[model samples]
Target chain A: MILKSLIFINGFALFIGFLILFLDKVISRYGTVTITLNSEKEFKAEGGKSLLRVLFENKYFIPSACGGKGTCGYCKLVVSEGGGEALPTESLVLTPKEIRQGYRMSCQLKVRSDMAIYIPPEYLEIKEYTGEIVSTELVTSDIREIKIKLVEPESISFKPGQYVQIRFDVDGDFDYRAYSVASHPDTQGEIEINVKLIPEGLGSTYLHALRPGDTVYFSGPYGDFFLNTDSKRKIVCCAGGVGLAPLKAIARYWLTHASNREIEFYFGSRTTKDLYDHSMFEEMAGKSPNFKYFPALSDEDPEWDGERGFIHTIIDRHLEGGYKAEAYLCGPPIMIDAVTDVLLSKGVPQERILYDKF
Target chain B: MNLALILFASIITSNIALTYFLGMCPFVSISKNIRVASGMGIAVTIVMTVTASANWLILNKVLIPMGLQYLQFLVFIITIATLVQIIEIFLDRFSPALYHAFGIFLPLITVNCAILGVSLFAMLRVYTFWQTVAFAFGSGIGWFLAIIAIGGLRKKLMFADPPENFGAAGITAILAGIMALAFIGFTGIASL
Candidate 1:
């Protein structure tokens, strides 16, 4: 009787499983559809996958934070044709104005039919790269510097201050977190990034645990906070904590590529131990007449000798007569706001003051 | 057993939501907006009807005949989950409009205690096949009514400006409690 009951239960379960499978096969089979991008590129994609996944497979990387969950609202793209009405989930993330303008979260949009989408010009250049960690060093107590050597398609071309998104698999769903490149853009075969542990931050925890031989997948060359090489005005760069990564790239690229341009870099930390790699900037300053390095500490310390107090308070002392400078600020929101105010008051035009706040 | 009375009692007096309080998770969450709440309600009603009826058949015919009545809980839940999946696929294929309206909510219904509760209750009450269907449908409608009412109340309560300590969830719980009390008024009018 027990054997008979076991067989009966198994038979019932198998029958239901097969039934569900049959229904899924018949119902979800939407066939193949053509995905046209930017009115220029077109590819055939399976109808079941989301537009974001389809695009990702095609090597076109769109910046998204919450993977394809539609929670981040960062994967917005212009779907010009064959895109249906926005679903309820998409409506929560998208503004009414954006919806009216035909912007939809590609992650939430299932590719059920032939469709046309417009990708931004710069995003077209974004590429996914797989690399092995060449080195990992604890730059400070909280911050670690990771250097990665690209394996496939070994060279990457990106502006100095742009960032990349590292992909992580949480359960089965994909989650991406962005970090700015600290290495010089000219270092095409490799990249470096600094990660500061933010207790309980998923990306930081994962990245911090990575060893030298581990492999990672990341996409990009995103963000517009890069060095404006065309600008003839003097460059004023300021960074706080780990925000120095992108600014380091920008300053080093500027110092190496265009040494004729006057540039000053100001790095702020809480204490002496919080500050890192001032010697590298000092070395660069010694070589280049136009480059000046100022490392400041906000908190009191007996061992400190350089500028004290906030970086915003010391900005005026450096630019007594020189106000024709474009400011590049990257830090916490409060620091960025305070520094931007100082730069604006110092006669830097609002448009010329670029910032990326963490 | 009078099927009409079962239906009436379930919908008005012994509502699965207000009285039994089975599917409180979706009740509080989906009740924030009437449109989504109605969609969820309709989806829950459809799922409950089919799963409850299927479970009743399985319990009376297969389980009792095989003397495997002890496996009722497991078998009933499996039936509900599989039936929900099949219903979702069928709705997607045949009823495109209805599928678009509540299709996304089908996944949410798979683990809903309310659906499981209907099947278990039918088993406990020794309900016949048709009676189980009526009870499930009525319970679904009862849940639907409660959520919609709470949603409308919450919408108006947004402007009332309750204390800061009573956040959205806190305010919603209070609203559900009050609504449950109001539903109690119909207790003696009709009962199973």
Candidate 2:
């Protein structure tokens, strides 16, 4: 009797599934969608798919951190025609200028009919690069410094603080997760990112399980979280844990020009062992008079000589005449919020403080 | 019962929110603005009416014959979810304006109690097919009327100075109570 009952239940489920599929075939089937790209190229995509999914399938990947979940506003395209009105979710991300210019979130854009779209030229250049892991070092207990040398393209160049989206194949579907480029910009054939393992994070788990010399597919440097070269304000950088990656690149990138401007770097860790590298910053500061390094430890540690307590609190005692200082902060939200609160308290305008929180 | 009386009874006399109190979720949450409230109301009414008749068919033709009457809740929900999905895809492909107008609310209808409630009520009351259709349509319109009315009142309430205790939800709840009392008068007009 139990066996019969189980069989009946399975049969019912299968019948419902098949029934739904048959109905979908009759009702929701659209043959094809023609998409015009940049007014120069055109391609036909399978109809009844989101524009983001179709574009990625065709190898024209617009950067989407949320994997077409419509949370991140990265995958935006200007639809010249055949694209419907802005989705409610798109309003959270698109500026008034972008909205007027007919920008729509590609993830939310369902390709029902032929569409003419304008994609940024930079995004058009975004391509997947195959590389071999040159080295993977335990920079800290939780952090790994992954250096990948491109085998195909041989090189990648990016602004000091921009990030790259590494495509990870998890559960048979590729998810693109963004990471800031940690290595110096001068490194032509290689790029490094400091990845701290996030608890149960698919991307971090995949990155952490990699062996040296394994082939890696990390795509181009994306994101506008770069240093403003035009700004003459004193650059004050605050970092926590693996957040030091982008700030290191920005600080070193600024060192080449020297700008004759003061650049103070504040790196905070739980203890001395959690810190990635202090000697590199110290060596750079020794040579550059305008450069300064302040490494702070939040927890107690023996035989350590540096500023103690939270990095924000440490910077609180030192920030003076900060009217000309533009703070660049990168870290976890706790540190970002603490540093931002401290910075704001010291009369730093909200616009002058820029940060990337993980 | 006649169709016009059912319609009128649903819209005024026996409002789903104000009378049966079936769809209070959308009534309270989406009843802030008149435009959104009307959109939500229309969407709910359409969903409720469609789901009710469809559930009636399933309950009679599928469950009753098979002696699987105990599976009413599960099957009913599956039918409602499937129907909502079909409506969404249809709207997306053919009616972009309506799809955009519905936005998140169309997808949200799957979880709404009002759609499921109409199906349950139809099953419980043991109405015939035609009667079931009328009740479903009436119930939907009644829900629409209640939400839109509340929506308009709430918008005006925004400009009015209510007591300190009447913040968004408190004021809306108090108003709902008064409206429910008014709807009690409609009970004398129609006996659905």
How many residue pairs clash (N, CA or C atoms closer than 3 angstroms) in each of the candidate models, in the order given?
0, 0
Taking the candidates in order, what DockQ does each have? 0.46, 0.42
Q: Which stretches of candidate 2 lie over 4 Å from their true place?
A: A1-11, A21-29, A61-72, A227-234, A254-262, A319-327, A333-354, B1-8
Top DockQ hit: 1
Cα lDDT of model 1 by residue, B1-192, tens digit: 899999999998999999888999999888888999999998999888888988888889889988899888888878988988888777765655577788568888989999999999998898889999999999999999988998999999978999989988889898888888888888879877
Candidate 1's displacement at residue A54, Å, is 1.2
Give RMSD (Å) of candidate 2 vs. truth: 3.2
lDDT of 2 by residue, A265-287 (tens): 89999998897788888988898
Colliding pairs, model 2: none
| Error in Å for residue B21 of model 1 | 5.7
- Candidate 2: CAPRI quality band: acceptable
